[model samples]
Target: MAVTLTEAAARHVARYLGRRGKGVGVRLGVKTTGCSGLAYKLEYADEAAPEDVVFEEHGVKVLVDPKSLPYLDGTQLDFVREGLNEGFKFHNPREKDRCGCGESFRV
Candidate 1:
């Protein structure tokens, strides 16, 4: 029933917010798409909805909508560096399978 960001992720998000000068937090959600049927959606939230579930970790806020809560509960967002490529990765405990391309997941 909660989502969190890794220390690296929090730092990465904080740096971007610092540069942008405005943003309440990051919003995490799910969308139906890709080979596995669901893909992760992320965006910088300028404001929070009244019903948004907010989890604060490492000094960064992670927001989730009620509709998306079940699919994303207990997920941890991490910022990682692999060779020359670096990006945010999802550690979702509810995921039963991930697509071959790693763009989507099924639970």
Candidate 2:
């Protein structure tokens, strides 16, 4: 079970961290919300919790809590640009369905 970030994502995150100047890494998790019952949660982590799992890829650290591991395992995160919009995208193999608005997922 693991989570990783693409090179582009790493660069993007690193840039953000550099600008913020106070973050150790990024945290990825799930929360109950949205039309599909679950939505992705992301935040800048200044420190790692004892129960957190960390994965380093492309020189960036990705943090995840134990409770979110099962739902996020084997997920590869990518930074993408579509027309004038750009953001992080999750490539989760365990996702069975995504809400119509693309804000949440169910597995």
Candidate 3:
């Protein structure tokens, strides 16, 4: 029941926060949409909610709400670069499959 960020992901998040000059950490959650029935959501969190489960790795705080914990537990997030595209990737052990477009997942 844990979520973590890779060093590269941490560095990228830190840089963004530094430039913005605000935000306590990043929030990770799931939304009920997309072809696979669930989509990952990421945003800067200025504060933590009472229900949030927080994990700190590489000096970056990752927040997950209680409802999303089951879906995202043991997930390791990574920042990756592939040609001209770059983004955060989710290494989720619970994922059974992902959509063709890679925007959503099923577990």
Candidate 4:
């Protein structure tokens, strides 16, 4: 039960943190919305909450709330560049299906 980041994601996050100068790591979570019932939520974390679960890889940290753990376990996040578009993508083995718009998923 862990959430990890790909090397590209780690490097991108590390570089961004270096530029921001104040974050401790990135936070990963889930929200209730969309047709599939859950949406991934991610943001740069300035600090970890008392109950946050933390995973570190490639010298980068990813924080997850307990409530989001079950949904996010075994998930790997990656930073990708396709043509002129670049963004973070999630690879979750537990996902059963996602909406047609790809905005959400269900495990």
The Cα local distance difference test for each model comes to 0.95, 0.94, 0.95, 0.97
lDDT of 4 at 17: 99
| lDDT score, candidate 3, position 10 | 98
In terms of lDDT, model 4 sits at: 0.97
Q: Once superposed on the true structure, which residue ranges of model 2 sit more than 4 Å away at CA? A: none
After superposition on all CA atoms, how large is the RMSD of candidate 2? 0.7
Q: Compared with the true structure, what per-residue lDDT tens digits does model 4 show for residues 1-107?
A: 89999999999999999999989999999999999999999999999999999999999999999999999999999999999999999999999999999999999
The numbered model that scores best in lDDT is 4
Listed per candidate, the RMSD to the true structure in angstroms reads 0.7, 0.7, 0.7, 0.5
Q: How large an RMSD does model 1 have?
A: 0.7
Model 3: ten consecutive residues of lowest lDDT: 32-41
**lDDT value, residue 62 of candidate 4:** 99
Report the C-alpha lDDT of model 3 over 69-107, residue by residue, as the tens digit. Answer: 999999999999999999999999999999999988999
| 1 or 4, greater by lDDT | 4
- The C-alpha TM-scores of every prediction are 0.97, 0.97, 0.97, 0.98
Model 4 CA deviation exceeding 4 Å by range: none
Lowest-scoring 10 consecutive residues by lDDT in candidate 2? 35-44
Q: Quote the lDDT for 12 in model 3.
A: 97
